[model samples]
Target: MHKLGYFYLPSGKQIALEISESTNKYRYSTNKDKVKFPNIESIIKLFDQTPPFDNSRNLSHFEQIREFTIAKGGRKGFTVYIYECEFNKMKEIKGSPFSKYGDGHESLGLKRGSRVIGRYIDTGKKYKDKYVFSSISLINDN
Candidate 1:
């Protein structure tokens, strides 16, 4: 598994996030096997330079759920489930136009509440009063 990034919990424990082509079942069918993992250094640099939302704290780890939709292109909707590591409160961030229509999170062995690390940018797109990510990657920590 290639180390993609790290998630730092509020308690100061760091979790190493990783990914592997073997875990991706659709790699042979798609170009996923050839796709390079996002640069961890670049992601961290971007995150550090970006300002946090008013009521948002740096995300440690998150849960993801893909809701099926009949909208144009038949793309599924994505909802990020966040539990504030410090506050222990549940919050949600929802959005549409998810690009994965064929093999999705499930194909990567990801479930509704699977622990994941993600990367997002300030695209000025708001989803249900929260910022939406430009892209996210599933962590295959096996």
Candidate 2:
């Protein structure tokens, strides 16, 4: 693995926000009415609502994802947020990722902290322990 990016949010509870790969398109919109938060329903669906019901906890978790990088900004109503997370690519030592599991091979300088429900930066979201964040963004030079 290789360290390619980082996320400002807490370490767990992967976020699946969908944004266009085009930077120009991100800021430029023909429609005057723009929604600040899109795909909110989709984000809500990722939570668990049964037994020990963590709906509120999960919802709060999803909201903590801060704006890592402004993908596009202008005179638009709302700015397009593009967060990046590439901690998985980092090289690990010869041991289990979790200390409780085996010899444990963490703190290789890739992840800032252990996989725990750390409160996200400023957000009160008690994120889970290292949820596999999917559809993470790639650094866009263009």
Candidate 3:
């Protein structure tokens, strides 16, 4: 198995993962914690990608907005909005995209207690959480 690197969680914990070159199966372990966590496949599915691997259709879902807070300094001279969201009523995670305009959340019409279909992109760095997405869009069901 080859190491793909670590997956960080919102709780500040990380999972070390290795994948088989031939089988593509993932093996993971947490850093000194024995807490039960999402399986490898589910964790992998949380990431959004481009063509061929763009499974946004399957991954994007209606996330109930719990609350949001505005923060500064994600990008140099830019503002970031940190959103607290829940998925499948099971997991609560923070999602945000660094914005030069400081209106990414407003442009999306996002508000507390609202539900919107959201897509995510991997930032490849630890932000508010391991699943921090670089961007999100409103999914039109029609």
Q: For every model shown, what is its TM-score relative to the native structure?
A: 0.19, 0.23, 0.19
What lDDT is reached at residue 129 by model 1? 38
Candidate 3 minimal-lDDT segment of 10 residues:
61-70
Tens-digit lDDT track for model 1 on 83-131?
Answer: 1112432233222223442222343345633423233221223333333
Give candidate 3 regions above 4 Å deviation.
1-5, 9-102, 112-119, 123-142
Question: CA lDDT, every prediction?
Answer: 0.31, 0.28, 0.31
TM-score (C-alpha) between model 1 and the true structure: 0.19
Candidate 2, 4-123: lDDT as tens digits = 112232221233122322233456676465534335564444333222223345444333222222332212212111122246442222331332311121222334234331323223
lDDT of 3 by residue, 19-116 (tens): 22212332235345344544666545433221122233343312111111112233343333333444622222333443532344344455522322
Clashes of 3: 0
Flag clash pairs in model 1.
Answer: none
lDDT of 1: 0.31
